[model samples]
Target chain A: MHTLREIEERARAAADKPAPYGSDLDLAAYIDEAPERSYVDSLEQLEELGEEELARAGVVKSGRQRSGSFVQIDGSVVHRKALEKGLEILSTREALEKYDWLWGYYWKAVAVDSDKYTAAVEMGPYEGYFMRALPGSRTIYPLQACLYIREPRFVQRVHNIIIAEEGSELHIITGCASEHRIQAGLHLGVSEFYVKKGARITFTMVHNWAEGMDVRPRSGIVVEEGGLFMSNYVVMEPVRSLQLYPTARLVGEGATARFHAILVAQPGSEMDVGSRVILSAPRCSAEIVSRAITKGGYIAARGHIRGEVGGVRAHLECRGLILDERGVIHAVPELEGRAEDVDMSHEAAVGKIAQEEVEYLMARGLSEEEAVSTIVRGFLNVKIEGLPPLLEREMRRMMELSEEKAL
Target chain B: MDTMRLGLGGGDLEEAREDKETVLRVEDLHVEVEGRRILHGVNLEIKCGETHVLFGPNGSGKTTLLMAVMGFPRYRVTRGRIFLGEEDITGLPPHERARRGIGIMFQRPPTVRGVSLAQIVALCSRDGVDVEGLAADLNLGDFLSRDVNHGFSGGEIKRSELLQLLAQDPRVVLLDEPESGVDMENLQLVGRAIRKLLQKDLRRRRTRCGLIITHTGYILDYVEADVGHVLCDGAIVCSGNPREQLEGIRRYGFEECARCTR
Candidate 1:
């Protein structure tokens, strides 16, 4: 019953959310000064601050890189090749910050009172931003970016890029959240993981947006030899609709990929999630795990882990826990093994909290609801132990953002 | 004279007013589960400050009787009434019964993950119980910050369950096989924890009453048992000295007691 700004003024503090640490990046104060990442017309006359400067300058190199060939089940080989082209997105800070939410899939807000648009936050270019990892120095520390769009606008678009040198390891975490109820928004973001041989990249994202928030994040990872890629995504929002699929192509020998996710949809939210892995090299391994929870809510999880090249083994596991009767969950884990010698398997489970389990705690004097809350918290906690203290704090901080309860 | 009708018409019987000290009294309790009959008219009573043992074979309605007493929904009492200090509680919900100062220690206990033991102990307390002091009593001073029961060993579970029951401050405590899967040392820990629950005076309050449902008599040796009943075939077929029944059954079996049935 309030305007977007007024509502944002009254909502619970982000501190109640789960992340273990707060970032120094002040969204309200970041100046639009020079564009974060934009192209220069003269490439030959630019001076840079080492690799960081090159990355910030949007100059990266990729060519004639042959990692190895992975033999498929049909005896065909997937030859590892260089990513032929480069992609860039440049925008002013205000233009990018206008759509703050990272996974806002849907929203609708017009001056906070002109009740005409019931738009859902859609991930696209408006919420879009660009970054070029400096050209030469291999990036070791990953960058963290976040978008928080309130109800005044439910639509958004985002584009991001990362370029790795011959040898570097980078980790990134991105998030999306809404500011107003029923804010219709959109998110369409592209992440180009241009990895040179022997570089490692890990991208982890956690979303706890409202039920109306919808998200679709697309990623492309081209891995060279001895490189690695990992994805950790934990989403606990029912109303915020979502569709995220990260693609990885292992181009180098010993290239590896792993994706782990936990989805919890409480009453009144809907989510559709998916992931895919393409192995084109021998000795390449990929693992995908999706944990989904639906309580009076809905979750559809689909994943594909394929072994296209010979000597490549991939594993996929998806587990879902539905707390109440009305809650629904659907999970499909697919394994496409092209090589007969490839080792691959997929498993998925969906279930509710056991009655005896509830009675067990009740006999000890705890209420049924309290028991379920504890169980749910513990089940997802297995992933919390692995997150960085700061990211963990941030993840926890976003958990309280669910309009249902105070943190 | 006792079996014959002896009171004025429409007048309540005076017997209910007499044994005011009897904290728990069950008469002719017939319980069923899933349309399958279980307990057949079982009668048992425990006076204040007394530890009563309900012994039985598996599926002997031991756990069923405990669940019914604890007011679990699945177990139905077809006939008879469970009286707690003259109050007829044959049709009360589990939480209602819990509020009325009744608690239990589950046989197959479920862990309370993510919720701190301290927090759980406070929420489950009928008398606003303190978690740390109770944990210390049961030698759980170090695990208070951890989640309830999750990842705990058998002994930790038993001890922690007792810690929770101690916090409840109930007049009658129902234990559903407290010694299952526990080792000898853990069994000792269980016995000690129960002893503390039975004897402690929290902030100067009345001691708790106990109803222990167990197959083994190890708990009996550690905690004093004022009355013992063997439940089998849906009823109490035998009742006598706790030690005598335990030792006698170990050597002579139920067939020996069947010969002397009512």
Candidate 2:
């Protein structure tokens, strides 16, 4: 583990390095602008935003009152809540002293440079959540977190960490959103997760942004032997541009990692999203499934799975639907096998809805618009079994609302 | 006097004598699909509470006539107008025609991905007809949640079509080859469903109207056909008693009917 001084120095040194891929966006212009203070008039604004965006992200605010849940606003921790025992929820600055052993995973970034965003965040990093589930702890209820933006032309950079110790299980639901009418803003987030031996962690992230916003999220996960890591990511709202490619690596025998993502690119938006998984140990397995819809926008849906050891199995599936003539959907699926006994497979397809299928629905008393909405809803409905009932219901409701807006 | 006419050897005069009101009327209908004319100057009419069966050989424009009447965008009508119960629907879209009480069971409906059969059926129902109950009646209870016509067997596909028809309950039902690919077991169920859909109940006289297109004449065994018209080369060449016409065509074939009409 590197010292805090070394971490700061590395971030400054690596700040000028260009992104390895997906750098079609303009980060210099955003870096030149000064960050603004969040202009939230009242809690009602945050509550309204919660209903408009966070609800789709599966975080239902209890009336206008902030419940006993962790909530952050404009890169600052506003409300903090967690279980009393076997769990610790704190900000990165607060956690620096109490959990010295955690610096190895939290302070030392992997696979992503601190300078990925021009060192704007690493030089004077903003506050983000740190959740740790002690060994043998198990909870049915998921920890809820929200990161909200209320000001225009502001930059909210967050670095979050989740560590599930040996034999523990934890699920976290995080929602990120901003005011729908905000002028322009940027959100750069980095998240790292550690699932120890025999531990399990399921992370669900929902993102809803305004049309002038640009988002870049970098995340990675490491699963120890006999551990499991599952992730569900959904983005339904429109934004100027979004680029994310989260990776999960199974480094121990019999570990498993699964990723399911659903994205919608509205008019004038560009999205380059994907999930990558690497099975590095024998008997390890991984599955990546993604469904993308482009309505008058552009989307590059990407997926990659690698089986690097014998007796490993991995598969990737990516499907896209283009609903408008002006829309463009691209699928990029890659698979690599390094051992003779490894099994890897991938499938990808992109197309528009068929005319006959639309006519068939029209024959059944549905108007053309109604028929299209029904078909798009069904196309976006990729079943993820074993999801908690409440989360599943809210997720489905969000998809329905998204489909209604698309039509 | 009947043999003096050009097409169908004289069904117009007989149609004028009927007391029932005409439910559907096609006059000088010429339809083209994909720049190729498939129907030419076809004239046909069916009254309320009447069932008309059209018989012809393969590629004889039987399916094209039904599709044209349904107002499919691809099946362009170059001439003539279609009337349903005093209203002209020649230029209306398929869904508009459906709203005005026109329903069709296609010979081979294409499979729809992700849309369930029950979902489409629910859309067609205005009276809140028990979808699951109707599926049970047509032996499609197990396929209620499956994608429409996806991976369905021949019999199951037929049954699914009938299930949709039952839910729709339209005033004018157009069936294209109801028994062409169905087996005996499913045929009975499909026929029963069609009979019920047309209100052919023993307790009450049949009131719903239908225009059926068949090549095998096997459906005649299950439903009462008031008339049989042999359509050859996109024109009705002969019309007579349903059973008598079937027997003659069975022995002499459509070639004889075309020759006799000429």
Candidate 3:
């Protein structure tokens, strides 16, 4: 394992390197410093933060249905608590300072010097959530985390690590948002997830940002034997520019991974989002599904699945809908098979909603506008397999709410 | 059999039928699809409580007539007007026509991905109808959660269409080949569903009207009709007793029927 000095040295060397995808932004334009926020013992003390805004980001202010709650505003960790036993939630900085072994997992799944974003998160002053589920432990409700930017023209850098120990189940709902009045801001986040043998992790994220906000998130996951990792992401509001591509690697036998994303880009917004999975073990499988809709904006929806061993199976589906004449959608799906017996496939489609589909609904007594909205709602609805019923319902409700606001 | 009435004008017919309230009337209706003229001066009228069967060969504009009446943009009504009661509805859109009480069952409907059958059924019902109970009666209770018409068998599609119509409860129903893809076992179920939708059991108090286009005339065995018209080459060539028209077409074929009318 590398020491902290070596990781910082590597990040500094690649601080100027640019990413391969998405438009590059000048990191110097955003302010890295902000006024410190005092820590809150309980989430109820956060009532000063608009409950409506917090709820829009999928955060329950009361924490009634959350197993744990973590809230970080700007560069400070304001609130972090574990309501249930056998679960741990802490600020990443504190966790690193408390546990000496965290260095082994940090920058292990994700390379430190891979791009400028990763390097910036490592070289800059950042605070994120660290969550872990003890071995054989399972929570009835998912843990909640929120990364909020309350300052204007500020850059919020975060690095998160999540682990599900052997025979344990962990579900997380992470929401990233900015203050309503703050228009110009930037968010750069790096997340690493580890699923041990016989473990499962379901991560659902919702993004509600201002019209002038720019976000770039980099995430990676590693799954062991018989483990499963499922992720669902949604972004319905407007952003100036947002880009992310999270990848998962299945390294043990019979492991599985699935990713589902729903994106809506309103006017003046540009989003580039994709998911990639590499299956390297026998009997492993992966699926990546994405649905993107643009209303006078631009979106690039992409998916990649690679099967590296015999008896492995993977599929990728990317579909997009263009709602306005000024809107544009690009779908890119890729499938690769390295072994002779590996099975990998992909399907991609991008266009406007079929007029025949609209007319079909109209025949059932829906007006033209109502029919179009219903079809759009269905297009964005994806039923994720293996998701807990409560999380599924919550995700549906969130999607419906955002859909109403966006459409 | 009623003899074929040739050169009948719309004004004269309206004056002659002043006693009966016409629920649906099409006059001098000419239609085209994709710039190809399909129908030529077709005229028909269905009064309240009346059921009409249309018999024709392939590509004879039977479906086009129904589509034109439904006001689908594709089936352009090049020359004529459609009426529902006293209002002329030729300019209204399909959903407007539907809201005004006209429902149609397509022979091959497009599959709407991610839209469940139950959702569509609920949308069709203006009131809060028991969608699950209605679907169960149609043997489609389990299909409520499935996408609309996606991977549905031929018979399942028919039953699903019938379920939507039942929920809609329209005043005027247009059916295109209700028995085309149904098996022998499901044919009876489909027939009963259609009969119920048209209120056939009501006898004297029936208010629903239907215009059905059939190639095999198999639906006649379940739902009796008041009038039958044979459409040949986009024009109604003959109008007569429903059973006699079926027997005549079965024995002599559509070609002979068109020839005899000429």
Best candidate, TM-score-wise? 3
- Model 2 regions lying over 4 Å from their true place: A1-6, A24-28, A31-57, A63-68, A83-87, A107-109, A118-120, B1-17
Residues B1-262 of candidate 3 have per-residue lDDT tens digits of 1123532222344344456678998988999999999999998888887788999999999999999999999999889899999999999999999999999998999888889998898899968777788888999999999999999998999999999999998999999999998899999999999999899998576788999998898999999987788898999998767788889888988898899867
Those runs of model 3 whose alpha carbons end farther than 4 Å from true positions after fitting are: B1-19
Tens-digit lDDT track for model 2 on B1-262? 2221333333554755367777898988998989998888888878788788898888889988998888889999999889998999998988888888889998888887777898889888868788888888887888998988989988898889888988888889999999977889888888898888888774765557999988888888898787678888887877766677788789998899889877
lDDT of 2 at A350: 91
Q: How many residue pairs clash in each candidate?
A: 89, 0, 0
Q: Could you arrange the candidates by TM-score from highest to lowest?
A: 3, 2, 1
lDDT of 2 at A266: 92
TM, every model: 0.68, 0.91, 0.96
What is the alpha-carbon interface RMSD for each candidate?
A: 2.5, 1.2, 0.7
lDDT of 2 at B176: 94
Model 2 interface DockQ: 0.60
Candidate 2 lDDT score at position B244: 75
Looking at model 1 chain B, report the run of 10 residues with the lowest lDDT sum: B1-10
Q: Model 3 shows how many backbone clashes?
A: 0
Model 2, residue B257: C-alpha shift (Å) = 2.2
lDDT of 2 by residue, A1-407 (tens): 34667767777776776555555444565532333334333333454344556565556565222222556777667656664467777876678668777777864434435345635466655678888889999776677788877667777877788899999987787778888888788887778889999999888778878899988887889999999998888887898888888888899899999899988889998988988888899999998888888878889888888888899988898988887789888899999888899988888989988788788777777788887777787777677765777657656776665555654
The better-scoring model by DockQ among 2 and 3 is 3
lDDT of each: 0.61, 0.79, 0.90
- Point to the candidate with the largest lDDT: 3
Query: How well does model 3 score by local distance difference test?
Result: 0.90
Candidate order by lDDT, decreasing, is 3, 2, 1
